[model samples]
Target: MSHSHSPVSAPATNGHDLAARIAELLTQIDTVKAEYATLDKRANEVAGQLAQRFPVYDELYMSAATEYNRAQADLARTKQADTEPDIPLDDAEKASTPNQAVRSELSGSTHNAPISVNKLYRRIAQLAHPDKTDDSNKHTLFLEAKEAKKQGVLSELIRILALLTGDETRPEQLSQHQGQDALAEKLSRINVLRKELTLYRSQLMQLRNSPMARIVDLISTNTTLSITKAETLYKMTILQRVKELETNTSGIRQDIAFQSNMNKT
Candidate 1:
């Protein structure tokens, strides 16, 4: 009996080709990841410098914004409560207290669902599980995945999964055109990375155009203004801007209330 050897060799050849395609895609993904990390680090460093140079301005701005938001939320909640029917209270709580209304506002604001750290941990582990691979870096990948999950860094976990799995939408039954499909998926991912890179570049440009950043740039180029003087100027300018914003916010609030009263009437 003569047995054909072509059928046995074809599957092995296809497997090798598939592995090579996956490896190439992984390399490309790694390159994109490195570039993104660099951009993100630079953006953060620039932001940190701005914050450090003007700590008081940053703090005051944050506090004012927070207070404005909270006040607006409270006003809206009060208006909503006014439209609702009053419920009868128990004999012990016959008197309506200010604290009762405050508690209701707090309750409404505190209903967010809890994050499941364990679920994220499991997902990262499943993707980079060392038991599935004998590569030297498998152990390192597993450790990093575990730490990212522990710290609730979902983005890191997602990046790791993308590197390991090539494509999240990989079909269960890879057809004869598997290599073409893999290439297409990898190119799609690269497109996403390019878009993200553009966004980061735009953010960097915005930061560079900020008042504090412009002052820093001027000092760098002109060499006439000292760092201390430049920072002082930036602080003064930013404070004035903050005051203007606060005034505008207050005016808008008044206008909203007037319009609301008119609608009610």
Candidate 2:
């Protein structure tokens, strides 16, 4: 028997090769972001259609979803998976209550959070200002800085500042970076794009697995069905969901009641 080993690929060492790779990564990241946006839009459109067809289910579904989210958070807490699910709890919170989500987030993060997200954001903005920086990615960095500021994500602003200046601890060291090597900048840019690609792809996966995505998938998958047949099928599906929700909610309540009674005994 012959033993074989997998070949290892070498990293790009040439300046031109690194620059080309960075350009490619940027394109790929943009494509993934665009795809996620399109999918989200389609799901929202499908949800609106469902609402029009069965207005009554809308209230029931919202209530059921809220209860379901609460239960999930509690379960995750019990299991120590996270404060909620590890990946998308923030997205869920924002979707349900945008204003309250921000307040709650700030409240929870106050311990280690910066004194003021706005002030730190201003510092980052000044450091990465488009007019004061290289033209290649300054505008994009400025936009990301704004978003990080809005989201109260000080760490992200710090990371952006670090990438901008190629120095993690010295955010105001832009002067030293003015004459930085072009290859190093390209490498830093690729690192940023790689992170963005991962984030966008993760979001796409989450969206694909959401309940709203299921509705859009059903519509797309069964488009050949006669309109009346499709309508009937959808109605049945919505009815089943409402029934399941009622059953599950009632079951949870019964479990709690039983537990309380046992505790009293």
Candidate 3:
């Protein structure tokens, strides 16, 4: 009996189709990476500007505001105490006031403390006087320093001096470290962007394995599928993914604007 002839194989064309699709995807990925870099840079710029405008606000805004509020409350309390009649406390009440003698001694001795605390207070005032600087937080620090000196709390004055170190940088000196604040801000934003990039990369991988991407593979492996049909489907999938990336990009821009506005307010 005669041997059966081997089936004739059709021409292989999948290599070119797959190569083209991969190239297209790579191009899109590169574009997205470039855009992400630009966004990261912009975030840094915004942060830097904010840092310059409000150098101490980021670190001490709430604390300074709280201190100011507390001072106001103390003033109100003092005024109320002055308006009330100074009735002598009964023996029972006097016995309950545990620190009355100690407080009396401390108050009496405040005027007799050494001059070192006053010197330290003067040094802090020279460096952190609110009127000497443009920073509003410095005003709060100045007021706190004054109160600490008035109370003769050497430890409190020292603490205030330590905190003033960050505010001691003159505007001219600050110019030397341009973008440092922005760089700090950029780091936080970059972290967020990295997460988004990972998600997008995952999406890209999923898209690569999608039926449309497989169609291109099919065109390469199977002779029945046409190159034109496979390319068209691949492009459609890519376009869809690109649109999604664009939407994500738009949202990111909005977020940046919102953050910038919040800093302004």
lDDT for every model? 0.48, 0.55, 0.45
Model 3 alpha-carbon drift over 4 Å, by segment: 1-208, 211-213, 222-224
User: Where does the lowest 10-residue lDDT sum fall in candidate 3?
Assistant: 101-110
Model 1 Cα displacement at 218 (Å)?
4.9
lDDT of 3 at 41: 37
Which model, 2 or 3, shows the larger TM-score?
2
Q: TM-score order of candidates, best first?
A: 2, 1, 3
Q: Which lDDT tens digits does candidate 3 get at residues 90-158?
A: 221122222222111111111223124666676677667754667777778778878887787765565
Evaluate model 2: give its lDDT.
Answer: 0.55
Off by over 4 Å in 2: 1-11, 65-91, 94-147, 151-180, 209-211, 221-265
lDDT of 3: 0.45
lDDT of 1: 0.48
lDDT of 2 at 103: 19
- Best candidate per TM-score, number? 2
Residue-wise C-alpha lDDT for candidate 2, range 15-66, written one tens digit per residue:
7887889889879877876776677666556656666677675655666656
Residue pairs with backbone atoms closer than 3 Å in model 3 (clashes) = 14-220
